[model samples]
Target chain A: MFEHFPQRVLVNEVVTRDGFQSEAEFVPTATKIELINALSTQGLNKIEVTSFVSPRAVPNLRDAEEVVTALNRNTDTTYVALVPNERGCGRALALDLDEINLVMSVSETHNLANMRMTCAQSLDQFARISAMTAGSAMRLNGSLATAFGCPFEGLQTEDTVLHYIEAYLEQGLHSITLADTTGMAVPNQVYSLCRAVRARWPDLEVTLHFHNTRGLGLSNVLAALAAGMNQFDASLGGLGGCPFAPGATGNICTEDLVHMLAEMQLDCGVDLAGLLTQSRQLEAIVGHPLPGQINKAGLRTDTRPVPESVTQLRQSLEA
Target chain B: MFEHFPQRVLVNEVVTRDGFQSEAEFVPTATKIELINALSTQGLNKIEVTSFVSPRAVPNLRDAEEVVTALNRNTDTTYVALVPNERGCGRALALDLDEINLVMSVSETHNLANMRMTCAQSLDQFARISAMTAGSAMRLNGSLATAFGCPFEGLQTEDTVLHYIEAYLEQGLHSITLADTTGMAVPNQVYSLCRAVRARWPDLEVTLHFHNTRGLGLSNVLAALAAGMNQFDASLGGLGGCPFAPGATGNICTEDLVHMLAEMQLDCGVDLAGLLTQSRQLEAIVGHPLPGQINKAGLRTDTRPVPESVTQLRQSLEA
Candidate 1:
């Protein structure tokens, strides 16, 4: 309804990759396949199926290859995977993924802390992967981790982020994601950054990935939307936390984000009710209460009857 | 740096009233007094200290009179109390309150449900309160609960809200709060309604009160701020919820709200670090963890050293 907010936005579900990665115990392959299949039909624009990292590093996603093999793929929804390095990208190349996402942190220390590589090494890896996937059917999307701020280094500069975006564009990556890995983003900062990025590259695809660690996730989303972002990465049931930041909420929730979009009367095509139902299933799968609010507080349409106390008070007042 | 947003915004803390009102156990009179006293010194522009409702109705706030009397009065802060009817207003008039807040719901059903009175009856109560406070120095603030939407009646129209606001103004209330009682507000709706309100009543002191139930709390605040609001009501540690909406989050957290405002570099005068410390005390008082995120994640300035794993990865790469 506002000036700059696009009528249509793309919701990219990152539950399986980001959400499940934080689980203390392994989620079975069959269960993962079932969830992804169920979500594929729910009108999500894309699903980050899994991350193609070493099993020893992230044992929770040890079945990434198998999960990719068995997806009940939907033509309407593109399937994607997070590929960490050239070796991971090589594995994704063999898969039936529509897109392979290459990620690096905008912060130097966070790149070392998260990917065990310097920002330079990660850029080199993205270049090598871009060349490797040159002839492949799969497309590449560069994800900048700690694009807003770094937990180890505090707030990163906008110039640092812009330099990395320039590097990603050089690699022929059409889509780029601004990842708030630690949820340190403020709305004004989000608006300023997104406006700059959109102004610089009008045709480039930009997706916003936010964490709810500090409860600014959805606010940051609103700011980005107003600043001309139309693609977002959200975790189903509000799952995922960085391994370094224990007990912190990870991503903007899929159901909550969709509910807000629908409430704003934006034509973000995802079924809120279906996502709410899936959030329950995810809670059972993860064996804990999710951080998502829509699942707990039903949609605005879910009207309630008058409480007995209110009724009793009304009767007393009349008397 | 953006247009329309004022350099200085007022923070109104509502923990002792809204936050403690939902507590299953009665907080001791001394503890409530202690909390209120501590918050007064934290540079908060205003604080909804307690409600003048009946002890029989809200047993948790049975010590409302005691809390009001015990506050270490701060000249820099305005102390407020929510009074439902003439009798409650009468009790507040006898106290040392800076402001007596009159509350009602814009939604008809919610008005009846929350106050055990119709909208007309609530208006009559506000008129009675205005007359009661005419000779006294106490200012009156009209709080329109469910101003955004009603739990029992779905989405409420802005016209419905403006109608009640007009009635509230007729009673001589220069200040009013638009309360999202159940967190049904979307950013666009907030922006639209707030813009209209500011345009019509340029001199009215408007405060935005939001719940984090649907995870749109902070987003709604940003929208209202952009729409020309300069004051807000937030609870400490995010402690408060509608009794009807079970398992729902209540108001936007004081700490998180201040944290975001500080991060935006806005000239909101509250000390964020002090609120963070108080949140820990609030947790201890409640005997459970509250929903606020900043308390757990720390501030963006809270930087960590490089993790051991990252150090090992660096050493291996060097070797």
Candidate 2:
């Protein structure tokens, strides 16, 4: 089973766009730029810098253009952004972005609730964006939120996700992300679904976005890895959460994912120490402690000295 | 891969014993007894009620004998307690404990730190306890703390654990627990070690103890499960952390573990809602939010109604 792992995995950072959007108090554009600049140089494969959504809908990310424009973008890191409609996609295309993540939900109820549009309507939006972006160098990622299980609906079958993937392919998108928008995925469910997705589209690039709401995020990551998934979406300092799913936490922490990957001896290519430093900075910027555990508990190799009290007790016992 | 799972995994609850032992405020004896009584009836396979160590050392569980004597223990649940030496074993033998966990550390430094003794000395104590428990029905579980990793030392190899386990069998101990004392375990290490342990001793009732320090607790559980492990030790409300490992959190949460298992459709045989209730009550008793996520996040199936805001937005869009 350990042999099943690839030589390396790709970790796509989504903190600036997905993480910051969830915060009610808007982060300053400069701080967003500074954070992205710091993280981009840390060997991350990709960074979703900002979103081109309506300012009225997501006011926090109103400075999408400014953040992307002001970025001290690293050459090695691919820059990405989330786009919800034709206008958003057009905004993303105008920028020097490497990828545009078009978002939707497989569950009709979730699609209606999250996007205020039916699944069919969202597909139409995607089709229009794809038609306009034809022959463009910018990549497109069709992110299916609640691909695992929906809060409004229940568990989603692999077939349900595949059905959405079919539509995604029909719209000319080559890459897709199965987002556990509410952290409703279990290990076997993720393994089976990821296996099914790979079996259907061997050439497709699949990224898994998980929430630690129920604390199964990393476990689901392992399941995905077993089923030949090498791409993941994580947030720095464990930022961003599903506002509709009251109890759901944020995206899986970027530093912690890197730490786990490093421990497993899989090459994630991210500088974990740099990520942890940024996570600490993120805490100060967010004005609250984030959900990441590795930042709290240092690396496994970081061995602590035996406490003075324990040493004295041991000495006394020996005496 | 899914077919490798057992019909049901045996979850051993260790809140009252391991969790409360780390609490700064000593829980009142009655509260400890009440919590134990409440949890014993919740379909748990076993419950480690308390530690029979010197009251002066673990002041929180000073009323170990009293708590054990007073428990309204259910017939269906096997009652367990941690016992370190001859005296603690003697104390447990006088009570109604179904199993007495003989604790030790596979690493030399940890044994000296935690038990104020060397590994050899701890083994000698276990031998003495084994001699005393001869002809007794009370089962003994050799718990190898730092079996996965040590805080003062570092990552422990499976060989070191196997060496200690071999000694345990020599002392007539049939069951063993591989404790990740500082939550340093990764999935491959866990899977590899668990596979090694199972291969060496097929019939040994192996129980895995994990911590969420690095946030790989459940991920490690998935590894152990893949390695054919069916017994896990979890703390209610995610109580009981590594005192030596500064930022490390508590044990793998009982409710969260059960939630993941139930989601995988693996029979954990735990009452989820009942555990949630106890976890909430525990929070009130401990006077703080616990490290557990399920209590804060709720189960995946415990979906919320579509928010009135989302509904209004959808309605306005439709109109």
Candidate 3:
């Protein structure tokens, strides 16, 4: 199993977008830019800066353009933004972003509830956006939300998920992400679906987006890794969730994911200590505790001095 | 990977001893018995009822005798207790315990810190206890703490861990548990160790005890399951930790573990709903928020009514 894992994995930090979008309080644009800048210095290859969505729908990311435009762009980091539709794409095109992530739910019920559109309508919208971005330097990545399971529709069949993947490929989207938007994925389901996807599209750059809602986030990551997945989307401090999806919780924490990968000796490029520092900063900015464990527990390398009581007890026992 | 897992697994609840010991307040003896009685009804095959230790060492469990004697034991549940020395074994022997679990740290540093004894002395004490229990009806089991890693000693080599296993076997104890006492076991390490143990002792009843301190508890369970481990130790609400190990946290939550197993279609012979209910009751008794995710998120089977906004949005889209 150890030999089966990739020697190095790609971690795409989505804190600025996915981590902040669910915040009830609108995070300051300067703070968002500072986070992005801090993350860029930590050697993160990809940072999702913000989402270009209707302010009424997601007011937290209303200043998406300002956040993206104000970034001290690091040449080494690929800046990405979430684009919900062609309008969002138009807004993203006005800025300098390395990638535009387009998302749609695989379940029609979720799609209707979240986007006020059917799955087919969402696909049509994605096609329009894909065409609009054709020949542009910005990369287009499609995310199939609720691909594993949905709260409203229950478990999704492999065929249902495969259909959306096929549609994304047909739209000429080379980068696709399978998202467990409702935190309903198990390791077996993750492994089986990822294996099937890898078998069909051997060259596709597949990424996984998992929620720690039910506490199986890291397990699903390990499952996907076993299934040959190399790219994953994680939020700093385990922030963000789907506003429309009932019971949806935070995404897998970027620091926690990096900590686990580092412990496993898998190279993830991003510095774990730097990521933890950012998690602390985000926690302070959010004005509450964040869900990431490493930030609270400290790293395994952290060796605290032995307490005096224990030393005294040992000495007493020796005597 | 799913095919590699057993069709059914065994879940042993250890909230009484492992979970309650770490509580800052002593849960009332009557409440402890009530919780144990409730857990018994949940179809859990085994429950670690309490630890037989000095009151000075663990004042929380000072009423171990009272609690065990008052339990409304279910015929279907096997009651177990943690015994640290010969005196503990004597106390457990007086009760109608189904098993006595003897614990010692594999790391000399941790053994000195936690048990106030060296590894050799602890082994000798376990031997004396084993002798006292010879020809008794109750089963004797040994748990090697810090089997995965130690806070004071770092990662224990496989040879050192295997040596402790050999010593336990020589003590005429076939029922053995390997514990990640400090939550330091990664999936690869768990897989490798479980695989090695299974290969060495085909018929040995091996149980794994994991802590979720680093948020890899369930992932380690998945890894162990893939390596053919069938039995695990979990607490009701992710309670319990080693007071001696810095950064040590809760044991894997029984409800969360069962939820993951049921979602994966693996049978653990435990009712998740019943466990969740008991977790709620335990939470109220503890007077604080517990770490179990299922208690807060509700089970996946729990389907919430669709929000009115989603219905209105769908109707408007149709119009």
**Residue pairs in collision within model 1:** none
lDDT of each: 0.88, 0.88, 0.86
User: Candidate 3: TM of chain A?
Assistant: 0.96
Clash-forming residue pairs, model 3: none
Give stretches of model 3 more than 4 Å off.
A242-249, A309-319, B242-249, B312-319
Ranking by DockQ: 1, 2, 3
Chain B, per-candidate TM-score: 0.96, 0.96, 0.96
Error of 2 at B295 (Å): 1.2
| Predicted candidate 3, C-alpha RMSD | 1.8
Candidate 1 segments whose C-alpha is farther than 4 A from its true place:
A307-319, B308-319
Q: Could you report the Cα RMSD, in angstroms, for every candidate shown? A: 1.9, 1.9, 1.8
Per-residue CA lDDT of model 2 for A1-319, tens digit only, reads 5556668899999999889998989899999999999998899989999889899998999999999988887889989999989988889888879999999999878888888888999999999999989888988899999998888788888788999999999999969999999888888999899888888889898899998888888998898998889999999988888775555578999988999999888998888989988999999999987888888888989988777877787678679
How much is A161 displaced in model 1, in angstroms? 0.8
lDDT of 1 by residue, A1-319 (tens): 2588888999999999998987989999999999999999899999999999999988999999999999888999989999998899888988868999999999878888777788888888788888998987888899999989998888988889999999998878868999998888998899899989988998899999999999998998888988989999999989998655666788989999999999888888898888888999999999988999888888877888777877777678779
Complex DockQ per candidate: 0.64, 0.63, 0.53
